[model samples]
Target: MIKDIPEDKRNTFAAIGLLTVCWASAEYALDFIIRCVHERYGGSQIREAPPVSFKGKPPYLREAFANHPDLAGYLPQLNEFLEEAWQIAEQRHWCIHGSIDLRADASTFPISKIIHGKEHRQDTREFTARQIELLAGRASALSVNLIFFGIQTVRLMPKEEANKLLRELLRKYSAALPEDGPF
Candidate 1:
C-alpha cells in the first residue's frame, strides 16, 4: 500500500510514520515511568523512594506534572491511565521491532514474553494479530492528527495553540482505547 502511494502522498505517509514513531517512543517511556512508580508506591507498608533517577531536575514525568500542576490534582487516576497507555505502546513497539528480524523464525524468539503480562493471556498468534491491529489503528489516528497539526503549524499558529490542539487530540484518542495496564 505504501509503495502504491503517489509521490506527494509519499511525503504525507512519511510524516505519518515519523509521528507514529514519536508517539510510540513517548508511550514506551511513559509506561516505563509508570511501572517504576507503581512498583515504588503500590501496596508495601514502607514508603519506597521514587524509582526515577534524575541528573539535575526530577524525572520528566514529575516535571510534566509539576509544570501542568492540574495533573497533580488527579495524580492517581492520571498515573493509572498513563501506565495503561504505556503498556499498549510498549507491546506495539515490541511487535513492530521484533518483526524486523527477517531471517529468523518467530518461534526463535520467546513467544511467552509477548503476552505474559496482559490480563487476558492470548496465544502468540493472537497477540501478534492484536498488536498489528493496534498498530494499524494508531497509525490511522496519528496520520489524521499529524495532517491537521501540520496545516496549523504551516499557517503560523502560536506554539501554545498548536500544543493545546495536539494534547487534546492525543487525550481524546487515548481515552477512546481500552486500558492495557502498566508495562
Candidate 2:
C-alpha cells in the first residue's frame, strides 16, 4: 500500500523508464548491425532470433569482416566504437541491476545492490535526473551511429563486392521465399 509518493519518487520512476528505453534502443542497434552482416554475407543460414549474448556481437562482426576482405580495415575502427558502446552497456546493466529506493527528502533515486543476502547500502549510488538523461541521450545517439556504421560499411564496398554473395544466397533461398509477401 505505497501511496503519496513524493516528487522525487516520481522522478526516480521516470528515470527508470528512460533507462529502460535507452538499453532497449542500444540492444536493437547491436542486433541491427549483425543482421546487416548476415544479409550481406551469411545468407539465409543466419538465425532470425537475436544474438544470445551482447558481448558476442563484436566477435561475430569481426568474423564477418574476416570472411569478406573488402570489409577489411573497418574491424579495428568498429572495435573501438564497439568498446565505447560496451561501456555504456555496462552502465545500463548496473542501473538495471540496482534497486532504486526513494527517500522522502532525496532529489533522486538511491540505487543499491544486494550481495551475499545483504543490501550493501555503502555502495549505493544516487542517480540524478541529469545522469539518466545523459545515459538515454548517449544510447539514442549510439544507436543511430551503429545503424549508420553498418550502412557505411556496406556502401563502402564496390557494388559487386557488396552483393557478391547476396545474389547467390537469394538464388539458394529462392525456393523458400513465398511468392506472396515475406515467407
lDDT for position 151 in model 2? 59
- Tens-place lDDT per residue, model 2, 1-183, is 225766666666677678789768777867766776777666224345435588777767777776677677687878877886887777676678877765436566677765444654446677776787788788888876665566567542444543444455667877332233221
Q: Which lDDT values do the candidates have, in the order given?
A: 0.42, 0.67
| TM-score of candidate 1 on Cα atoms, chains taken together | 0.32
Per-residue CA lDDT of model 1 for 1-183, tens digit only, reads 768755543443354355467555544444444444334323112223333322211244444443443345545544544454445455555554333322323322323233555475544422333344555566445444433432332222355555566566668877432243110
Shift of residue 42 alpha carbon in model 1, Å: 25
Top model number, TM-score: 2
Find the 10 residues in a row with the least total lDDT in model 1.
49-58
Best prediction by lDDT: 2
lDDT of 2 at 182: 21
For candidate 2, list the clashing residue pairs, or say none: none
lDDT of 2: 0.67
| TM values, all candidates | 0.32, 0.66
